[model samples]
Target: MKITSAQAWWVQIPIEADKQHVSDFGRLRTFDSAILRLETDDGLVGWGEGKNAAGSAGDYGTLVHLLNTEFGQRLIGRDPADVTYIWEDFYNGVRAGKARKAGHVMPDLARRGLTVAAISAIDIALWDILGKADGKPVWRLLGGAKSDRLRAYASGGWADKDNIGAQLQSYVDTGGFNGVKMRVGAMDGTPHRSAERVIAARNALGPDVELMVDAHGTYTVSDAKRFAYLVRDCDLAWFEEPVTGDDKIGMAEVRAASHMPISAGESEATRFDFRDLIVGRCVDILQPDPACCGGITEAMRIGTLASSFNLRLAPHLWAGAPCFFAGLHVCAASPASFMVEFSLGANPMIHNLSNDPVTVVDGMVAIPQTPGIGLDMNEAVIEKFAKKG
Candidate 1:
């Protein structure tokens, strides 16, 4: 079928917390998301979510306007099934400055957050359409190598530090998740107390269960080295974002100085950014958020590149709705991906948005067998919490 139209819907979803909490790494704030919907003349519809962080809503708003008003017109008579070709045309066309003069700014972190997010949603929808077109699942279309059951890690351990052990134990006991990651560096730059916390967790969980620590890019090189040295005997799976994402040199320094594997790149966007990381050998694990990192198309390319370098792909997921499903699909298709992240906090928007909410059984998540990301949006819930512009 030929292309017809593309539209963007910006919706606000509130977080349960009142004020934005400051973690040791990055600022935490809540806001609405900008969703993209693409439709073909034959009635195939695709969906995407843009990177809508705290103050980046306007960036996505502009991207949505450009896609709907400008790019949509250009792709009107083209075939929607040409996923790769269409992506190349759109991406290269923008680089060629065809859409740049049409009031669209060059993609930045804020712009890319929205651009990539929207692109990821559309890319996923396109893949879904491809699957339907071929009468198969998206994983099979991408050469399904593993089973549908994805090993899951119990995330969202941001409760009071005192309650962390109980919270982690509760998820392991109730959710049946054997692997768990805890949020470290809670506003304090020191690594001494945080290392103690890690030791305590190791003692509590014993040796078999996998435990990870996310510094959230909050520490300095020296601090990361200190923490890594203290917990070197604890057997952490990986140390995530030990320093800020921008500190490549610092990250490399941490990698050299510490025995633990360094993981990062969640704050990065596009393949160009990742190319630098890969070429520099800055990290051992690459965590690209499909929602933030130029969608599925780019993420697949990034995964391939990471595979070539023998790096692990574990996507960073912190948003609601489309973010989770999109990440899931990429993880399913990527051979190098080790695991998928799930937030354990009480998030009504995420729970109500998906027609098929994800289930984690025995520390693993079963991929949806349905069509088109294997999940449908809850329109009624969308309307109920829809943010007014």
Candidate 2:
């Protein structure tokens, strides 16, 4: 079937919490997610999501325009079944400027921002169309699942919260999460203060629970090293994006000096970007987000590359329902994938936007069994949160 049309919606769902949030990415506030919908000539429709942080962090408007105009123009007459070819062509159209004329070339990293994010949403929807058409789950289509369920870590332990210690304790006590990740780095005021927060979380969770820290690329090499050394006794599960994501050398240096397993790649958008990070020995764990890393098509490539290097993949999850399922399928099929990120906090989009939020039971999330990500989009939520013209 050929693609008929594509549309993007900007939805801002406010967040409610018992306490304040100062995540490494920023303070926890509203959930601003960009949703893409693609329809084929044969009447099959698919949903996808692009990551846009709360309070206009990402170029949401540009992403929406690209998908609805340029991206839609490119895919209208194309076969939906040729997922890989479509992905390559779309990448070329965005990055290479090939859509403008024949043999047009551009810089390698030219198309490396919200444009790629838009492409990711489109590519995922295309895969969903294929899975639904073939009557199989995306995981099965991606060479079958290695396990029925994947272990998940309770994500988002914001440092700004008043009861950071209690919040972490509650994750294990009530949410049944065996592992939990808390924010670290710049936003926590100072290195000593950040260390204090980490120590408090470790003390509260005890030794049994696996603890991870996400810096969200808020530190320099020296600062990251200092924080790492300060919390050396904490036995962190991994240090995520300790420094700027693009600084492979800094990442390697921090990894070496800290003597800890560093995790990155959520900010990386393509396999080419991943290659340098991998060969540079920047991290022990790779956290590619399917929503932004060229969807499942490129995420699988990133996963395979990580496996070859003996590096583990624990996908960084933060998008909406569609992107969440995309990450789940990739994790389900990848044996190297150890843990998936799950937000325990209140996200109206994730919880209210779908009938199924891929429930986590005892720190393990079951791979979606139904065809094509196995969850129906909640139109009601979309209508309620959709931005007006």
Candidate 3:
């Protein structure tokens, strides 16, 4: 189907004070996302999301602005089924024809950041349209799903040493999750402090339930190594983004010193960034946030990179409905994927933004069967949370 129009908006749903959590990103008072809407000439519609902030809260105004103006205008009359070509065109900018002829990427100088984030939304929406047009789920379009369901891990544990146990336990109790991840690093100020809190969480969850820690790339290499050492005996499922992705070598050093698997790339932008991570031996698991990492097209490439290297794929899915559903399809289809992340927070984008928030039962999430990303946009939440710029 040919695209007829495009629109996007910045939605910032405020979090209640009691539900707000402090992190390196500071107190998350709201969950923000840029949502894109694409309408085809044949009456089909698609939705997508782009995320600039790695955590729950950040400004989506500029992302929304980019899509609403330049990118949205450029989308009109394009073939929505030409997902890959459109993605390449967006990436290559002025040299798109040359890149297509050369059969290689001739990307624009502005290949990363907001440019890719905008491309992410466009790419996702295009895939949604393709799925709808083909009368198939995204996973089937990606190459038939391997399982009807995938294991899901509770992805929130932001409590103090005194209450961290209760917080993590509640997640396991609520979803029967076998695995759970907790925040650490900069928010706790010191590696030792973060370690103590993880210890508390582990003691409560016990060895049966797997524990993972996310430093949010906030720790120094040395601090990351220290944190890994302190929690060595905790049987962590993985140590996520122990140090900033900017320091690949330092992250490699942390991996070398750690006793558990290292996971990263929620802050990364394309298959290229993930390529460096895999080659450097920086991590055992790759975590590409579909919203920030060039959408489904690039995320699958990253997943292939993970499989080729004997690594695992566990995409970062702390995002809105479109992004979250996109991740679910990727995980369901990718052979390297062992699990999916379920955000255990009061995230409006994941819940109120759509007709149905994904449900976790006995620590498992079923692959979506509905065509496209399986989201029917909830206009009430949009009206309530949309930020006028």
- The lDDT leader among the candidates is 3
lDDT of each: 0.71, 0.81, 0.90
Candidates' RMSD to native: 4.3, 2.8, 1.0
The TM-score, computed over Cα atoms with residue i paired to residue i, of candidate 1 is 0.86
Candidate 1 positional error at 198, Å: 2.2
lDDT tens digits, residue span 300-337, model 2: 98999989999899887777888888898999888688
lDDT accuracy of residue 323 in candidate 2: 86
lDDT by residue (73-120, candidate 1, tens digit) is 676777767776666555554453554455443433344544555566
Model 1 ranges off by over 4 Å: 16-31, 52-75, 94-114
All candidates: TM-score: 0.86, 0.93, 0.98
Q: State the lDDT of candidate 3 residue by residue for 1-389, as single tens digits.
A: 68999999888888889888877888888888998989999999898999898555567788898999899999999999888988999999999999999999999997899999998998888888889898899999999899999999999988999999999999999988999999998989898999999999989988899999999899998888888889888999999998888999999999998779999999999999999999999999999999989999999999999999999999999988989999999998899999999999777678888787578999999888999877777978887878875
- How many residue pairs clash in each candidate at the backbone level? 2, 0, 0
**Span of ten consecutive residues with least summed lDDT in model 3:** 53-62
Better of 1 and 2 by TM-score: 2
lDDT of 3: 0.90
lDDT of 2 at 82: 88
